[model samples]
Target: MKLQKLIILFFFILIGFAGISQNIMEPKDLIPANDEIVNWQLIDSVNTYTDEDLYMYINGGADLYLEYGFNKLGSCKYRNRLASKIILEVYQMKNDAGAFGVFTINSSGKGKKIEIGNEAVQYDYYLHFWKQNYYVRCASTVKSEGVIDTLQQLAKQVASKIELPGKKPELFVLFNKTGYPFKQVKYFKGQVALANIFNFSHGSVAGFNEGISGKLDDKMVFVFSYENEKQRREWFASLKGKMNMSMLFDQYTTVEDGFTVKDRMGIMLSFKPVGKYILAIKGMDWPEAQPVFEKTSTNLP
Candidate 1:
C-alpha cells in the first residue's frame, strides 16, 4: 500500500509540473549577465493562458475579450536593480482586427499616441497598444527615475519579438467619410458586437466578416459587408419584407425605396442599401433623412 501510494503521488506530481510548463511564456530575453547594482536580483517568469483560462486571472468582464477572438496571453514581470518593477501582458488575438478591437475597447482618455507598433496610446502610469494580432498592456507602479522610459523600452523590446500583419481589414476602410466624423468611427465584427452598440437587429442570422459605423451629423450611420453579394442579397430581401410590412400599421410613408416608420412614441428611422453594404440614418425625419442617406450612399464602395 505504501509503494502504490508513492507511485500515485509521483504521477500527480508529473501532471502538476506539466500544467506549470503550459503557463510558461517567452516574451524575450532582455536580462544582462550582471547588473550595475552590487546586490541586484530579478523576479521574472513568463506565463501564458488561453481565453478560457482568462477568468482565472480576471474575475469578471472577460466576455468582451472572448468576443473579440482572444486566442492566448503572455505575461512578463520583473524587477530592476533599483527595485523598480515592470509588468506587461501580451494578448495574441485571432487577427489584426481582433487586436484593434481590444485596443479600441480599452483605449480611453486623450493619452499620447505613439508610433510603437501599428498604434500605441500611452498614459501616465501605463499604456495600451497593438500591432497585427497582439495587444499589449504595460504598467509600472514604480515612481523611480527613468521608470517611464524603462517601461517604454521594455514595451518596445517585447513588441519587437511579436509579428505584425501590417494590414487593416478591407471593410474597415469602406465607411463613408463625407459626413461622418473622423473621431467617432468604429470598426467591428460579429453580431453581438453590433447589437451591443449598433443594435441593428437582434440575433440576425447574417454573418458579417467586418463592418463600420460612424456619425453622420446628428444621425447615426452604419455600413456592413457580407461574405459575398449573395449573402448580402439574402439578408436584404428578408429585411425589406419585414420593414415594408411593419410600416403598414404605423405612421409611415414610403420614400427613397425605404419607408418612414414611426414608433408608438413617434420616432422615425430610415434605412437603405447602397451597393453591397447597408446604410442607416436614424434620429431624423424621413424627408430630411432621405437626402442624407442618399448622399451617404455615394461614399460607399
Candidate 2:
C-alpha cells in the first residue's frame, strides 16, 4: 500500500508541473474547427508567417507590422454549404501593447465597436480585435446578411479561445485624465506610423521610443515618450535645431523648458518637455495652449 501511494503522489506532482509549464495557445488553435460552428468548415490547413517572411505575405503593409513587434501569423479559410467563405488571420505580437497598437492603426475609428474581445470593431463583412498578445481579423469576400452573421460568429469563437485579458496602454489613461479625451487615437512605435499621421521631418523628434497622436477639437495633439529624461532632453535639443533649419516652421523660439514654432500654414504649435515626455499642441494660440500644457504637466507622473 505504501509503494502504491508514493507512485500516485509522484504522478500528481508531474501533472501539476506539466500544467504550470504549458505554453500559450498557438494562433491556429484559436480558430473554430469543422462543425465547431454549425455550418462552417475549415477549408485547409492554417498557413503561418514569421518576422522573416511576413513581407512575402503582406508585401506593402508588412513594414507597419514589423515596426509594432510582430511575431508570427496563422491564416486559413472557412467555407459554408452555399460556398460562402471567410478568411481568418490571427497575428501573435510581442506583447499586449503591440497587439493594441496594431488594432488601433488598422481600425477606421468609425466602425461599430463591439465587445467580442478586449476591444473590437465590426463592419459589414469584416471584423478585427485585440486581446492579450493576439490580433485577429475576420473578412468575407462578399457582403450578405448570412455572411455578415457568420463573420461575427467566427470572431466571437476566436475571441473566446483567447483566455487572457489586456488593457489599453498606460499613456492612454494619462491622456484621458489630462482632459484630452480623444475618441480615436493612434499609438505609434516609430517614425513609420508617426509619418502616417502627419509628416514631421524624418530626423526631427521622430526618434521617440513610443508616441501617440490624435485630433481633438480641430487641433492635433501629439505626445512623445523617451526611454529616460536624459534621452528626452537630448532629443528635444535636436528637435529645436532641426525645426530652425527646416522650412516647415517659420517662427522658432525657445521657451522655459521647451520651444514653440509656427508652420507655414500660420498655425502655432507649442511643445513642452516634462519628466520623460514631450507634449505638443498644434492649431492653438499661445494663450490657450499654455493652460492646456500646464494642466497636463501638473498631472504627469
Candidate 3:
C-alpha cells in the first residue's frame, strides 16, 4: 500500500511539471549570439491560473485587464491589468528589409485607456512577432513611449532573416502659386486636397476642378462642356469678357480635354506679377521657347 501511494504522488507531480514546461525557461531560452541584434531581455515570468485576469495601470487612473490563456510577462509595464479571457492568439514575424529581429508579444484583448495631459495621451499596444520581425501596434488610446527604440533593436536581431522583394520608383510633385506659400501636400488617387494655413493674406486661389469645371478657392464659378471647335470658340469669346486680367491666362489655356504641354498659347496670360511662374514642362529636357509657341498653336489648349 505504501509503495502504491508513493507512485501515485510521483505521477501527479510529473503531470503538473509537464503542463507548465512550455512557459519554463532553460539555458537555450537566451537568444543566440547572432540574434543579439534584437536586444530582448527577459523581464519576469509567472504561472497564473488559466482564467486569472492581468491588470494594467494607464496614465489617467484607468484600469485595464487582459483575458488570459498562456501569457508571458516581460519588462514592459501596462497601465491596467490584462484579463485572461480575451487573448485569442500570439505569434512572431520577421522584417523583409534586414531591419529588425525576432521578438515575442501578445494579442486580442479588450483595449481601454484614459487621457493624460493635453500633449501626453494614453494608448494601448498590441504585440506581435513573426519569424524575423517584431511589431507592436497601437490598438487603443494610449501610445507606446519607446516604440522606435524597441523596433530598432528588433531589426538588428532579424537582419539576416529578412528577404526583401523588388521595388518600383515613382515621382510626385505639387504645383501651387496662389500668393500663399504652397504648403506641402500628399497625392492620393488622382485628386489634390488643399488645406488653409490660416494666414492673413486674402487674394483668392484658383485651380481646375474635375476636368470640365473651374473653382475659385472655396467657390464654384463656372462649368464648361464644349464638344466642338465652334462651341469652344463661342465659349472663349464669352469667357474673355467676364474674367479678370489675372484669370485670362487660365481661361486661354483651358480646353475641352484639359491643358496640354504642346499648347503654350496661354503662357503670355499666365505669367504672374513678380515674374515668378509655374511652368508644366513634359519631356526629358526643357524645350526652346520657339518650339513651345509653335506646339501651343497646333495643340487644342
TM-score of each: 0.66, 0.86, 0.20
Clashes of each: 0, 0, 50
At residue 6, candidate 3 shows an lDDT of: 100
lDDT by residue for model 1 over 10-73, one digit each (tens)? 9999999985444333333322212522232335556777868977766785676787898887
The worst-scoring run of ten residues by lDDT in candidate 3 lies at: 96-105
Instruction: Estimate, for each residue in 1-301, the C-alpha lDDT of model 3 and write its tens digit.
Output: 9999999999999998985454233212222232242333322331221112223312321111111111222122112233111111211111211101111112212222222111111224333332212122222223445543343343233222322221111111112222222222121111111112111012222221111111223321111223444644544443333333433233334433223222133222221111111122222112232233233223223
Best by lDDT: 2
Model 1 lDDT vs. the true structure?
0.65
| TM-score leader | 2
lDDT of 2 by residue, 6-75 (tens): 9999999999887533535788788788877778888978888988689888859788888999999999
Where in model 2 is the C-alpha error above 4 Å?
1-23, 80-84
Candidate closer to the true structure by lDDT (higher is better), 1 or 2: 2
TM-score for candidate 3, residues paired by index? 0.20
Worst 10 residues of 1 by lDDT: 29-38
Report the error of model 3 at residue 212, Å.
21
Q: In candidate 2, what residue range of length 10 has the lowest lDDT sum?
A: 18-27
lDDT of 2 at 164: 76
